[model samples]
Target chain A: MTRYTQPTTFYTKEHEWVTVHNDLATVGITHYAENQLGDIVFVELPDVGAEFATGDDMAVVESVKAASDVYAPIAGKVVEVNAVLADKPETVNESPREKGWFCVLEIKDGAEIASLMDEEAYKAFCEGL
Target chain B: MSDPTTENLKRTPLYDVHVEHGAKLVPFAGYEMPVQYPMGVKDEHLWTREQAGLFDVSHMGPCFLSLEDGIGGGDEAHAKIAALVETLVPSDIAGLKEGQARLTVLLNEDGGILDDLIITRPIGEAAQGSLYIVVNGAVKDADWALFERSFQGKAVLTRADDRILFALQGPKAVDVMSDFFPGCEELKFMHHMPFELSGTSCIVSRCGYTGEDGFEVLVKPEAGLPLVKEMLTDERVKPIGLGARDSLRLEAGLCLYGHDMDPTRDPVEADLAWVIQKVRRERADFPGAERILKARAEGPAEKRVGIRPLERAPAREGTMIEVDGQPVGIVTSGGFGPSVDHPVAMGYVRSDLAEPGTKIDLMVRGKARPAEVVSLPFVPHNYKR
Candidate 1:
């Protein structure tokens, strides 16, 4: 039941969402992405302290239908992951933008977040697909 | 996503209904079929297991094979028709009771399975000596050609490919279907009969790809929408798409013709030896009987077995399986079983590695994930007697 209300949230063409709070950016897939993947059964998350470049494959989200790669929208080091998803993967479908956040990353370059699409831009991008 | 060349795809009789119900259509078996609906594949799959799910199987090939001369006068004419069909596939067709149906495999001369089909002998006295057969949509043309060539000048083939075939499956299917067809509840699994529905003569078979007790109704194309809409009026009945159909059948341990087994694999290797009856084995007269019987006696080099991956990651089709670091087989069908709530797969492995409890590794994205060779039917079947 979690809602997407945060205004600082950004999105990638791969359907990942990034919400910047101070220097840390929280990452998770968008609802549009979860709908396409169907019922998620497994999620492979990166470990804390792991470094990733912008657009690098950082996690794998597997659903009943297919497996998809979640890429990092900004270069950063993983700081935290939603360990709850290990046991309740359906959260990605139920609350993808909020409690279903995959991980929190310590941002290395704040400017990379600006390059991503905002909510309005992301909506249009999804429509194009 | 829409396909640019969707005009080239064939649409089923219920295509507009699917579109109206918010189905996500995709190209499958040359048809623009609905893969899933707004409820999603997982929900559709689980719903069918608990209630009743209706599927548009109109894309499949449903036809009748009748002897040139009218049948039912005596056993001689019936036996002649059965013998003609036996020439193409290995099954005890002559032993099939009037209303009984049998699942058989179409074999090539080299002992490979061309396709798997359901053949049922009509029950009505008027339709005697006629066999109602349903083959895979992808290979229906080839099957028709085989039938024409094999039964040249002996029998007349009637194509009902334009007919609407709907499969109403799951636990509550009997209750919902019995209300409509009245005597359908009396038909046991693998039995079929001709019934009149709303002034339309239709054939209802108490069988389905899903392990659940169900009935497949074949009606005229014009009656397809009305029949489906009427069935949906029942609270337990929901329109299911191919996505749930695949998962449900996979959990039931039913093989998908192209994905699980194709013309390259034989029945014995596919673990379908039961389809080859004792009488057929003794006669050794069907196509590829020499190699099929030999494999049945000595065992096939590789056999299909169910697999349970120790990890949550599904080992999809084409994933290589290894035993103690040595490659032995490849997965033919693998996916997350919604009913079992785990990842299940079926693959062909060396006969030695096909035993239950044998430990193996599935190469998923180049990593060796632990798995075990287990028995088929990730979920137990619930067929009504």
Candidate 2:
């Protein structure tokens, strides 16, 4: 399994996680988000060449309970998606932060990443919920 | 995140037990019910199918309809009470054997379903003049009002809404129940009998919504928690919630009262004609009999059918269904089937498009997803006779 243990990861209010490395950023849902979804069965990913704005619905994660939209954490162009999720959607429930990353985006504006919540703030936000 | 809509939500008898088990509570049918436990919906669903899962259905209406004094006794009282109830529904209530249950639908004047319920004739001489009825939780108040207006002065309706109703469903359900209450194994499908569990008077019915061999126990409010705790002591049993219950019923092709069929949809159109027995059809004496019988003979315009989306994406309720670019119908209930390991749906469609293998399109997020009409009970039933 692909492992992602980056310390610079940022989180959105919508429960998406972003880990920026150089000019590209990897995006996925947080563990708390996947726990709320409950056993994802399908993942609809955007095309690799598609462009998205921050907060736009970039993908859909459907579970046995309900379907939820995964929003983009930063404005960028999609570079790659986790193709393995097509046959194995449970990866999100198993590992929402690592191998379950939805897609990687070529960063359009670096300053947008700085506006997201840090790990401490994200933990506090989840606790409040 | 505090919403005022949840302020008036009610709690079931097992509310504290659910919270202690780390359940995720959600508002359903005007009650704050647990949607799933820490095991999640899929895992809970699979556990019920493989072993046994206990569900707290206390929110549903469980009541008894008893005849007044001098209403006759023994078989005469049963016949009179059945005749009175037959006026509201299209089931063969009079023909039901003592200790037998039948699945029936309450009808409106226009022949649409008010609610689907399980009505049983109790055993023994003491409860002979009464019928035990269980209705959906969401419409219990409306159902009670209808009964009051329809059968006023004829029968006394006693509401046991505070009593807890738990359904233990799975292949191993009978085994577990037999272990708990000896002789429960003798109860056949659709049969119910009064029994005592740990010195508590309870009723155990050999029936459930899931297509599995199971039993539904109706117990006093105070005995609910202890009964659940005792059942969970067995390795085969676990506490299931509403999320898995929904998916399990969907997989079994059971129609949800409000979502699958309601006051606007009749039983014939819902493909539940078998519920209306042949003798009742000939008599044509119940409410909406004219419209229901006409639809039965000539067939309805649209019919409910099972759907399997070719893609992995789940098509949810209210999704539009089309055929050859023409709108046909809308999905009533759709979701992922944990047992089938695929997505399954049920909806009404033009009679011409209701046949199995007929291709259709499900409009999902502005795209038409390929799907096909298929036979129901996405997963086969395993009822023990």
Candidate 3:
């Protein structure tokens, strides 16, 4: 079972989204990223306890067409991974925002979250592409 | 994401039609081709297997090869022209019957594959001396340059690539094409005939790369737009893209030039020895015939075979194949096979380990993923005999 907090979600230019709750952050690709991938068949998630730097490659998503890398949005240590994606990678395409969340990280610095875009700014960023 | 680079990419005659139907265009073989439509690659690939799928193949090289001294009527002219082309390829072109076609390869002097192509003999008596040829788009200029050097004044090459060449493929291809070209069912697999439709001349060939029962139509530039638009109106026919095309052919065990086989690989090693006729093998009279025949007799050191990744992930091209950590082979093409419901791949392994059921390890992302050597065509071909 997981606990909830008053959360604030932020977006990255590479199409990743992170929702911060105190010192913890949950990471996943944005809906726009998954839609572009199309029918993702496999998702390679980082192991729990793995450490990552800002913009480091943390996961890989593969569609029938090709494979794409998902980068870490902020420096942190992974605490949990979405294991359900191993059996049902299509969840990324079907419900990218909710059930498809990739992993949870314990952040080292709260200030890094400020560099990401808000919901409105992220939606506008996708439209320009 | 890339506007500057795409600005220089060439567009096909049906570019506007693809855009109108919501296709995602990407750079392929120097052309901006649709990689998928709103339906996406997986759905589009399965749709082609269950129903008919239309494809824009305008980028392919289509041409007519004929004698320069002016072609004469009857069998004699065909024999002369076939003899000229036979000098470059290993297939028995001279034996091709009227309206018959053969899938063959362009060989280098050392018998390495330059490109794979289809050569056909037209039906009409007046078309005897000419052979209809289609080569890969990326290497068309190189192929034509070789032809000019070899044929010189002996033969002439007339390129028809400016015209629109499209393929209508799948089990229901006949149903869709019948509405456009009646009496098409009479043509058997690997055969073709010319047709006249409302002042437009078209060549319909009963062959395709997807291993499905289908037709490849070569249409003049003037009538391409309207004819393709009309074909799309059929519910069974949907426009396919390069993404589905790759997966479909991979499932069919067909080779893509510069992938499964290249200039360094010969026919026998590529498991394409079937293209060589008995007469050609007996005579030993093609470029690099000595090396190719020697490998055929004793077998090549490496052989291309079908492979399946036992795990969920796919082993893409350039993935190394090993046995207990020892490198033995390498994957040339691989990806998720939507129809097979798993990952299917093709690669070259040591001849000793090429048999079906031989176990191999695929080095993907620095990890040894278990895989097995399997027979070709993960999906059975549905060609019309």
Candidate 4:
């Protein structure tokens, strides 16, 4: 628990977003993800207490076009999930960065998230695509 | 990465129109086409059911097959052309009335379906010996080749895909079409006629992919370009892209060529036994009639049926269908049905399990999702019968 220093938000190359605060993290897909996915119909969440290693396929997001996998940003133990997504999957499209979050995790390593792209870097990364 | 596939893709006559409407272009069946406009897919799909949606379908295969030696006159000439083509298909082409269109499938020697198509005999003495045929876009080359091989010295086959083809679909389509063609509103389902549009004669058919009452118009690009613009200006019509076109057809229980039916499967297996008319069944002279009639009598091992996911999860293509922990079938086409407001799918299940209300489970992402084998057309067809 005492491995790293400051808190920060980061993004993965696969278009997921995460915010770390102390030992806990909040995770969701990015605005780019929602836009690319179009109208989302279902969000299949991982069960509470489910464990995942970095880069593992952690969740599934099914849209009208197709289903896409949301990978784990870092090693983490799932503590909570957004139940609202089951009823209102479009929330992911309406407010992807805020209320449209997927789940919360008890992160294992701060260094894994620290090395990811920042908001500015992610903007540039998406621009290149 | 180098895009070898995108290098040879073709563009439609309405490419500029789609770009002007802020369409997101994607490569489909060797063409650069709009998958959706700025309004997005879901809204585009719903709009077509509630209002008129204009779809550019120029990429599909529309061709004219006529007798090579030229016709003498009247119903005899139409029968002559019809009899020649009936050799390849099981449907009674010779039985088609003037201006009437019938849906049928092209078959291989083993009773496997090569492609599904609509063939319409023209309605006049001048065009008596010619048949207007439309096949799927993806397998068009093979379809044309089949035609060329079968009718080499007997009939002339000409490709009409260069001419712009478009569909106006939805509940408001008849109202929109009437403003252009005076008698379009009165055209019966599965029928067509020649109409004057943009000062040029065009073929207008009261048929569509969406289950709505609509028209499919074929015209030269010069006239088509302006007609599309004029229709968009009207309040009832909007430009719809391929994405909506797909969901609309799926909801309507229409089959996508490569997805639902293929060369390895026969028409009976594809649940298209209705295409074979009774007169032809008795005659039984078409290709693979022996094997096809056998399937019709005894039924195919697997049958295509409608599947509705009881849960929120969508069972996509290639998803396994199971019963009692045993594999029974696989989903052919599945997606979020915007109109139904849930996940809708179609698949081939074993004959015993292909009944309406039959309970099954779809393996989506390795989890069993409860589903039911329901009757097709998740939405009711509103065709003007």
Give the best candidate by TM-score.
3
| Local distance difference test scores for all models | 0.89, 0.91, 0.93, 0.92
Tens-digit lDDT track for model 3 on B1-385?
A: 7667788889889999999999999988889999999999999999999999999999999999998987768799999999999999999999999999999999999999999999999887787888899999999999999988999989999999889999999999998888888989888999998889769888999999898899999998788779899999889999999999999999999999999999999999999999999999998999989999999999999999999999999899999999978999999999999999898999999999999999999998888999999999999999988
lDDT of 4 by residue, B1-385 (tens): 2357768899999999999999988889889999999888999999999999999999999999989988548798888899889999999999998899999999999888899999998988888889999998889999999999999998999999999999999999999889888888888999999987668888999999988899999999999898899999999899998889988999999998888988888889899999999999999988889988999999999999999999989899999999999999999999989999999999999999998999999999888999999999999999888
Among all windows of 10 consecutive residues in model 2 chain A, the one with the lowest summed lDDT is A1-10
Docking category of candidate 2: medium
What's model 1's overall lDDT? 0.89
Shift in Å, residue B273, candidate 2: 0.4
Name the weakest run of 10 consecutive residues (lDDT summed) in model 1 chain B: B70-79
- Candidate 2, B1-385: lDDT as tens digits: 5767889999988898898888888898888898999999999999999999999898899999888654347788898899989999899999989899999999999999999999999897667778999999999999999998888888888998888899999988899999777898999999988887657889999999889889999998767678788888889999999999999999999999988999999999999999999999999988899999998899899999999999999999999999878899999999999999999999999998999999999998878999999999898888878
The parts of candidate 4 lying over 4 Å away from their true place are A1-7, B1-4
CA lDDT, candidate 2, residue A65 = 86
- Model 3 residue B162 lDDT score: 89
DockQ for model 3?
0.74
Q: How many clashing residue pairs appear in each of the predictions shown?
A: 0, 0, 0, 0
Deviation of model 4 at A11, angstroms: 1.6
Q: Candidate 1, residue A13: CA error in Å?
A: 1.7
Give the distance in Å from residue B32's predicted Cα in candidate 4 to where it truly belongs.
0.6
